[model samples]
Target: MSSSDIFIGEVIGTAVLILLGGGVCAAVTLKHSKARNAGWLAITFGWGFAVLTGAYLAGGVSGAHLNPAVTVGLAIEGGTEWGKVPLYLFSQLLGAMIGAVLVWITYYGQFQAHLTDREIVGGPGAQDTVKAVPNSEPGPVLGIFSTGPEIRNVAQNLATEIIATVVLVLAILTQGLNAEGNGLGVLGGLITALVVVGIGLSLGGPTGYAINPVRDLGPRIVHAVLPLPNKGGSDWSYAWIPVAGPLIGGAIAGGLYNIAFA
Candidate 1:
């Protein structure tokens, strides 16, 4: 694909990916939404479908490496050229932010209703009380925008993200081998979507399976900047785990593939 194709395809593809993926999270978490309390299975399946849709949309144009981890893994595996890496990463991040904004717009009313409800925030006047770090934690709706750990252990959280992302990028890398080195081909999107769901079901309990650095960071940035009333801090302190762990995992997967699978 040409540079413009890659750029356009990644921006659109990644926007769709975050739109549906984060959209599912918002559906399950936010108030006054039909899919509220839909549980983890719903989220995993929703993300899988999101991946399927985004990948299928951009596959023909940019090979649809929507996740930066996938892009990095492929580059290390010699599938994508190093020169194109920056474009892919930049486009993915930009697309992810756009998608997050779309999610906010799609569920604007729910967000407003949820944030204003005292019970949702904590209690009466909780909105004013729920301050950042020194006083309290991030706001209630932050989870809809970014991943956070159920348990706050740095090593454990980092390891879980790395392992899960390694599984994701490795699965993507090997799919080409199964297809006789023809790339993902027609089944690639579906296969990758299923793999994402599998990872979520199996390993998502820890850090919400960020697996892709841009996926988490882009939306988290959006969360920080959006003018949502009563929304708390963006949890910038723990943000590095999602960004660093997946990147490290992608590089590791690439090196491992070269050593064994390639």
Candidate 2:
């Protein structure tokens, strides 16, 4: 495939990933809904399947490094071209944004309806009750459409992202190392899916374990742009951790894998 084709594939693959990924979050979190707080198990499995599909669709043509961290890690490990790294990252981010935009559109009506109902139910004096709704707060913030530990401290959140990314990258490296083919085939993809499930089941409690920067930032950008009642976009503050942590973890995993095997 040409570089342009690779770029297009990455963009489309990443978009699909975030659409399913964040769509699940919206399904489970929004008010007056059926899937609220259903369980972390569901989210984990959903994400696993989502990634599997995304990989199947894009792996052949573009290697499906839907996450920038993954692309960087592969490049650093000499598995991919350094010159293509920027293009891959840009494509992933663009795809993520597109996916996020679709997610916002999919759930916008529901969000607005919930918000309006809440206002009517609460009347003018229920400030606290309104604040409890996801994305109702005014300004940039994480976990607006999701839930994490009660503590909102940055250090704790960053730690959660770091650990989650470490586990995810490690899993990716392991799969990359042992797979028989150049790209992950069906069996290999299934194993990678399981890895995501494990991460979500074990490490998803804090900050929702958004191990991919595209996964987190893409949806967060949508949250900012979409007009929902009493909504605020928490940008810049906690965003960096998701981007930084995953890249660091991916690099570490690549280095460790090389040291152990090479």
Candidate 3:
């Protein structure tokens, strides 16, 4: 694909990925929504379908490497050109941010209702206090935008993200590669989606299984900047792990692929 196609496809694909993926989080987490409290299984299946939808929409145009982790892994594995990596990353991040904003818009009323609830915020003006990430736990809605650790330990959280991401990137490297050695062809997309669901079901408890760097960082940035009252802090303190751990995991998966499967 050409540069423009790659850029557009990635932007669209990633936006849809985050929109649907984050949409589920919002549906299940935010108050007043029908899907609220739908639980982890709902989120995993929602995200899986999100992947399938995005991959299908962009597969023809850009091969739909919607995640930077996938892009990096493919580059290291020699399936994608290093020269295109920056474009892919930028587009994906941009798309993810757009998607996150869309989620906020789609559930604007729900967000307002949830955050302003005295019980949810603990009091009338608690959002002001929750704005500082270093001072205390994250805002109530942070999980809608990005992942966080249940235990808040750096080592364990980082390890969970890295391991989950390795499984993700490695699966794409091996199973998502079609006969042409390019994108996740039709069936591959479905299988990859299922793999994501599997990752979420089996490994999401630790750190929400962020496996993709931009998937976490982009939305977190939006979470910080968006004008939502009582939205609380973006949790910047734990941000780097999702970014670094996924990249490390992608690189490790690529190297491991070369060692054993290349």
Candidate 4:
């Protein structure tokens, strides 16, 4: 495929990925939505479906490497060319940002209602008995857009991201290797989608299973820049964990694949 094809495919595919994925988070978290408080099962399946749809739509053109970590892993695994890496990353990030904006637009009323109502959002006993770090000026709704660790231990959080992402990228890399070197084939999208759901169900509790740098960072950037009422800090301080861990995990998966599976 041409460079334009790759760019357009990734942008559109990733935008849909984030729209449905982030949209599900909004559905579950935001107030006054029908799916509000629908719980973790909904989110895991929602994200899996998001991956399925996006990959099926974009795989032909760009191999549907929606996540930068996946792209890097593929490149390291020799499935993707190094020259094309930058284009993929840029397109994915841009698409993620666009998708997040769409989510806000779709759930504008819910966000406004949720952010404005403090009692409903962070009630009297929101923190529980645990001693929470003091945030003098907290933003309320950033969680809808990005992931945050339930427990804020930097090393643990980073390790969680790395471990989860390794599983993700490794599953992706091993999609369809056969004596024929068939390589993922049509079943790749569906299988990888299920893998994503599994990761979310099992590993998401720790660091929200970001596994994808652009998926977390792009939306976080949107949350920081957009003028949402009481949309708390972007948590830039914890941002690097998601980005760095997934990247490191992807690279590790690449090396492992070359060593054991290639």
Candidate 5:
């Protein structure tokens, strides 16, 4: 495919991923909804399916490494061209940002309505009401942005993200290796979905298992700019963990895969 084609596919695929993936979160979290606090299982599956579809769509063109961690990891593993890495990573991040923006637009009306209802129900004395309403607002599930451990500490959250990303990257590497010059077809994608489900079921209670910078940062940006009831800016305090953990995990997975297979 041409360079322009690759860029287009990256943007469209990432937009679809975030639209469906983050859209599910909005459906579940926003007030006056049926899926409120439906638990991490739903989210995990939602993201998994999102990634699967996105990958299938863009794999041929851009390889669908929508997450920077994945792109970096693949490069380190010698599966990706080094020269193309910068372009791909940039495209992925840009695509993710665009996708996140689209998600915000799609859900803005619902979020506004929910926030207005909350403000009315809570009365003027509510803490959120007392705070100055910003030009933009955060999303309903704000916790997803920053890592908060079950123990409510940074170390734990970092650990959780690292472990989750490790599992995710490992799954990807394993699938690639097992392909034996062949490609992972649909079954491989399903395996990835299952891996996400496992992580959500097992490790999601803590840190919310960011596992991907694009997954967290893109949506977090939306949360920061989109109007809502009582939204806050990007939770910078805990933001580093999601990015750091995923990168470390991907690196570890790549190294381990190399050792085990070589």
Candidate 6:
């Protein structure tokens, strides 16, 4: 595909990915949504479905490498050109931002209620923990848009991301080595989506399983900038772990693929 094709495909695919993914988060977290408090199984499956939908929609055009870590891993494995990596990353980030904004718009009322409902009696639920103190840091609502460590240990969180991302990228690399040469042919998308669901279920408990760099960063940036009511801090301090650990893990996966699988 040409540059424009790759860019547009990634943008649309990633936007859809985040839209559905964030939508699920909003559904489970927000007060008024019908799926409120649906729990983590719904989220894991929802995100898997999101990946399946996005990859299928964009797979024909740009291979549907919507995550920067995926793109980097592919490039390191000689599956993608170095020159195109920047475009892919930029498009993914842009798509993530756009998707996040759409989520905010879709759940505008819910977010408002979720944020301010703390004043009201039994507002939202136990997840609605942020009280929004004056000038206080970003609150717990961030989990809807981005990932955070449950234990808050930098080394442990980073290690979790790296290890989980290795599993993810390695799965992709293995699946992509099919006869078709396309990274995870149409059926592989579904399988990869399941792999993501697996990661979320098995390894996600520690750090929310943010194995994708753009997936976390884009929405986190939107969280920081958007004028949502009483939306707490963006948690910039821990942002680097998701990005760096995933990149490191992806690169290691590529290296491992080269040494062991290739």
Of 2 and 6, the candidate ranking higher by lDDT: 6
- Which pairs of residues clash in candidate 3, taking residues 3 or more apart in a chain or in different chains? none
User: What RMSD does each model have against the real structure?
Assistant: 2.4, 3.8, 2.2, 4.7, 3.5, 3.4
After TM-score superposition, the amount by which residue 147's alpha carbon in candidate 3 deviates from its true location, in angstroms, is 0.4
**Per-residue lDDT of candidate 6, residues 1-262 (tens digit):** 6889888889999999999999999999888899999999999999999999999988888888888878878888888888888999999999998988899999999887777775532345523444443324546568888998889899999999999999989899888544222456778899999999999999999998889898899999999888776676788888999999999999989899889888
Clashing pairs in 4: 139-232, 140-232, 176-184
Question: By the TM-score metric, which is better: model 1 or model 6?
Answer: 1
85-182 in candidate 3: lDDT tens per residue? 99999999999999999999999999988877778877656555534223245788999999998898999999998899999999989874643335
Q: Which segments of model 3 are wrong by more than 4 Å?
A: 124-136, 176-181
lDDT of 5: 0.68
Off by over 4 Å in 2: 119-150, 177-182
- Distance (Å) between predicted and true CA of 189, model 5? 1.6
Model 1, residue 216: distance off in Å is: 0.2
What is the RMSD of candidate 4? Answer: 4.7
Candidate 4 has an lDDT of 0.84
Candidate 5 Cα outliers beyond 4 Å, as residue runs = 119-140, 144-148, 177-184
Model 2: ten consecutive residues of lowest lDDT: 138-147
lDDT of 4 by residue, 70-171 (tens): 888888888877888899899999999999999999999998787666474465544342112233333566777788888999999999999999999999
| Candidate 1 lDDT by residue in tens digits, 30-58 | 98999999999999999999999999898
Worst 10 residues of 6 by lDDT: 126-135
Q: What local distance difference test score does each model get?
A: 0.89, 0.70, 0.89, 0.84, 0.68, 0.86
